[model samples]
Target: METKKYPIIVEQFHFDMVDPKTDTNQNVQVAMRQVEPSDPARKDELKSGNMFEIMVPFDVIPPQAGFRVSGKITRVVQTLDYFGQANEISPDDLEKLSRPLIEYIETLTYQVTAVALDKGYQLEFEASGNQKDNQ
Candidate 1:
């Protein structure tokens, strides 16, 4: 299958080199983004199931950093008013009635952590809460 590239800025990064040479512990900075599927075929996949996936660079922790990222975006029914009522919409049911316009997943808040890089490679990384953006 033909694939195109998209941008993915690492929102959170945490690395501890027990053995940076071979350990992947210091390399996985997977970030999740919520987006609407661009292709019709791709949209079908997400509609089939409310489940989604996380795309990763094929090389994974390459000599150079920053790679393209993409993933499936499934509908997530979130309550606008938590204390108002309990009438929540199930993801399955939402896809069933995909009408004139499809309801996309609405994301409010995100906790992104970013690590400083030294020429395409991670220099120093620290873990923090979802409160503020990491640098």
Candidate 2:
């Protein structure tokens, strides 16, 4: 049997900061959820296996730093061939698909901190095998 294949493309992306700057030493938390598109056309596209959406919400707290960041990143990914349900995608695959958005988060945080503080702070995220499903 031939393996089904799907090419994923990001259709839309948006990022927003909740608390742009903060002075607190707290741990970082990251979570991801599959969101339903608000647009009827987008919903149809998703139902037809043409696309799906994933939102990653994160919070970063620096230790004794002048600046902290908390934001959410949402990306709409298009699947070119595979016409399967969103829940059918594996966790590993989901992590791989969300990698770019995660990197964006890191990049933006670094850039923002560079100006907010005297130096830039680097952040690294690892797949903790924890996936949250929000309906």
- Considering every candidate listed, which one attains the maximal TM-score? 2
lDDT of 1 at 87: 23
Model 2 quality (TM-score) = 0.60
lDDT of 2 by residue, 1-135 (tens): 112223333333332333535544333333334445677775765544445666666655554444545666666666655567677777777777777777776677677666656466676666783322111
Measured by TM-score, how close is model 1 to the native structure?
0.20
After TM-score superposition, what is the CA distance of residue 13 in candidate 1 from its true location, in Å?
16
RMSD versus native structure for model 2 = 8.1
Instruction: Report how far off residue 1 is in candidate 1 (Å).
Output: 26
Query: Candidate 1 residues 1-135, lDDT tens each?
Result: 111223322332232222224422222122223344667676654443232222221112222233221222222222222212212334343323221111111011111113222322322322221111112
Worst 10 residues of 2 by lDDT: 1-10
- Model 2, CA-based lDDT: 0.55
Candidate 2: residue 41 lDDT (0-100): 71
